[model samples]
Structures are given as C-alpha cells and as structure tokens.
Target: MSLTNKAERSLISHEEYEIVRLTHHPDIYDVAGEDLQATRKRLRDLQEKERTLAREKRRISRGKAEPRGGSFPGTQERPSQRKQVFAAAVKRLSREIDRRARIAARAPQAEIAERALAMRRENFNASHAAADTANEGMQVIASRRRRTTVHPGKVGRVSQRTKAAQARRDAKG
Candidate 1:
C-alpha cells in the first residue's frame, strides 16, 4: 500500500500510468512505436498526465479540496502525506517523458553514425586496393623512363690550357 501505488491505481488507463514495481526489473524502453508522430503524441499524453497530477496536488495544497487520505486522528493520515504521493507521481511521469524524448532524439543520430562508419570502411578498402594496384603501374613507368647521362665538358668557364690549344689550332688553320 505504497502511496505511489495508490496514485497509480487511481489513474485511468488512458492516462497510461503504470504501477511502480518494487522488484528489480530491466528498463525496457518502449521504442516499437517510436516514430516522430508517435513520439510527439506520447510526449503530449505524458505531459498532460503530469499537468493533471500537478494541478491536483496544487489544489490540495491550497485547501481547495481535501487530499486523498483522511485527516482524521484515528486514520492518522495527514494532508502533507497525500500531497507527497501526488508530487512523487508527477515527478515520476516527468522523468519518464524526458527519458523518452532523449531516446527518440538519439535514434536517428545512431543510424547516421552507423551509416558514416560503413562509408568510411568502404572508402578505406577501396583506397587500399587502388594504392596496391597503382604501385605496380608506377614501378613499370619508372623502369621505362630514360636514363640520365653526364657531358664531359666544363660547366661555367673553359680552362687556360684548353684556350691556348684552341688558339694554336686556329693559327695552323
């Protein structure tokens, strides 16, 4: 008979409130119908429920209405205790809706990341193959290139001995 359980039980099915189980269970995200439209719809519904609970809690606190439990001494139920239950329910719903939003936001990003990784892997494989083939072609082209030869001539100025020999040859001619 936890207050959270009581609050959950009071809510209608349309409100989509589920009882908080005390036992340990996996956090099963309801992502099956999580398209953009569906996500928006669910967020709206959860926000509405949260707002309703908050309103009720406010009403009780403002003394506009009696809280869920009896204020009688025999029952020993306090108004503050009742308010706390609704507050907890509202907080829980808020957290659930926020988690859903985060999950929805991440879904597309995850898909894009997977696609990018696949593209990178494909490109890497292609580049490696191309490089391997190109290396052989490059070696073949290098072998076909003409070999360089050096000329046995003075680079800048002729030597004095070569100049005198040239003069004697010209005088004989």
Candidate 2:
C-alpha cells in the first residue's frame, strides 16, 4: 500500500498525525519558535499521543480483537494490516519524540549558558573599557577570515539512491 494512504488511515487522531508530521521535518524545533513552555506542552502532547498509539498497537499485536476484513477508511490497505500500520506509525513517532524531547530538555540549559556568556561579556567589557581608551589612537590591522574545514559543495548532498533508501526506511518505520 502507498505511504500516504497508510498514514492517513492510521488510528491516531488528526492532531497527533499533525504533530508526527511536523516532527519529521528538518526544522521542527524552529517551527516551535522561542517558547520553551510551548515546547514542553508540545512534548507532553506528543508523549501522550505516543503512549496512546503504543497501547493501540499493543492491543492489535496481541490479537485480542477479532480480525476484520475490508479496507480501512481512506486507504486501500486491508483491515488486517492495520496492526502493522499502527505499529509502524508508533515506532516512527516514538523515535522522533525521543529526539525532540532530548533537544527540548537541553533548551533550558542552552538558555542558561547564553545568559552566563552574556554576563561574562558584560564584565569583560566593563574591565576592558580603560584598555579600549588606551588603544584608541592605535591602527588596527584586519585579521584574515578563517577558512572552514567542511566544503560547501559537499554539504547536504543526498544521492538518488539515498533518497530511495530513506523513503524505504520511512515506509518500514
């Protein structure tokens, strides 16, 4: 079955699907913006969704429910395969949730480090004011720009094979 059809017919709610979709994007954290509390809430919601998906997946995997025939809503996949689809969705969502949660957990520490650096800069500037005045008449030579180790041309280049591999990986996950 096609990927979009499978995802659309997953047992997860619309909001949960949207969250999972956003988490797959490269710039997901940027979409969350500068709000730490909002990030926390989003993480909470995702965690809850993950838990729910997991429960549903577990129930299906257990075979406690009777196997139903026919295609699921909005998909060509048979109802019998809904278990696999839910499992795949839960696994993908869980991986992304873990990654996002780790980044979100570190955000506060990053903010603290930034504030400490700012304070250090302020103190350094206050102490260096006199030195700055003493060197006011001196001619300053411009420093050479530092060359980076990474080549720009080699950055972010994904081969067609790699793209296909990723697509397969996503489908499986």
Candidate 3:
C-alpha cells in the first residue's frame, strides 16, 4: 500500500492476482471457457495498472507515506480473447506459486528482523537514528537464532546503551 517494499514488506504478486481473480475477476479464471487469453490479459493489465500507480504514488510521496488505490481497466469484451488471456494467466500463476514458495522458504530472516526493529524504533521515537538500532538488532538476531558478531558495521549501527555505561562510570568515580 504505502510502498511497503521500502519497509521490507511483501508486495502482491501472481498469487494475489489469482485470489483476486477468483473472488473478483471471474472473467479471468474461467478454466473450461474458450476465452483463456482474454482472462490472462485482464490479469496482467490489472497488475500492470497497480504497479504503475504504486510507482507513481511512491515517487509523489515525500513526507509521511500514504497508500494509493489501484484502478483497474475494464473487463474483457470478446469471449475467445478472454479465454486466451486466462489460459496464459493460469500457467503463469502455477509457475509463480512454485517460485514464491521457494523464495519464502529461503527468506532472509535476519535483514527483515533488523528492519522491523528499526521501523518499530522509528515509530516509537522519531529521533531514533541508525546508532539507536543496535540493541534491537541484537534482539532480532537472537530471536532468529542467527550467529553474528553483532558489531556496529555488521549490524548497521552502534548500540545506544548509555545508561549502563553511565552507571559503570559513576561507580568508578
């Protein structure tokens, strides 16, 4: 919606298109119909329209991110053409499902976890900077069971545990 890609969130893809078509775009999911291509075109056209809108929305948004609604082109007219489009859509949908599953199984949990932590910190405190993302990063890494040095450069920021350091110095003083 609001360029969730920047937030490291998943974007709708072929699977979503399938679901949308099944629930909404019945003209595109007619398996036994003769107008397969027309359905596929409808699906592709919808996705293309959504992507174009999202790209434009992202480009236009400069401040707090906002969501953009995608507009769909009208439905297919010729039944034969629709069948052709749908046949292709089904084939692409199958391949995409398999591809997406493979990627889901190998998702980068560490980077995503780090980004989520950073986003949360930003949401809580507008002043939260890269330097303040350390402890949260560690928590993410630990939760995910990933082994890493947790170094500033590696984790993308420095730790902000000033209270602990201050207490140590005060005791010494």
Q: Which runs in model 2 stand beyond 4 Å of their true positions?
A: 6-80, 126-173
**Better structure of 1 and 3 per lDDT:** 1
Query: Per-prediction count of colliding residue pairs?
Result: 0, 0, 16
RMSD of each: 19.7, 19.4, 23.1
- lDDT of each residue in 89-124, candidate 3, tens digit only: 456555545555577666787678999888777566
Tens digits of per-residue lDDT for model 1 on 34-90?
333454455455445556656766787799987775442331223344344444544
Leading candidate by TM-score? 1
Worst 10 residues of 2 by lDDT: 75-84
**Quality of model 1 by C-alpha lDDT:** 0.51
Mind giving the per-residue lDDT tens digits that candidate 2 earns over 1-173?
A: 52564455374456545644544446454553444345446645555545554565466679876545544445322433434444444465456567778988999999999998887665555533333345455323333799668677666565766899999999998
Q: Which candidate is the best by lDDT?
A: 2
Which scores higher on lDDT, 1 or 2? 2
TM-score of 1: 0.35
Deviation (Å) of 28 in candidate 1 = 12
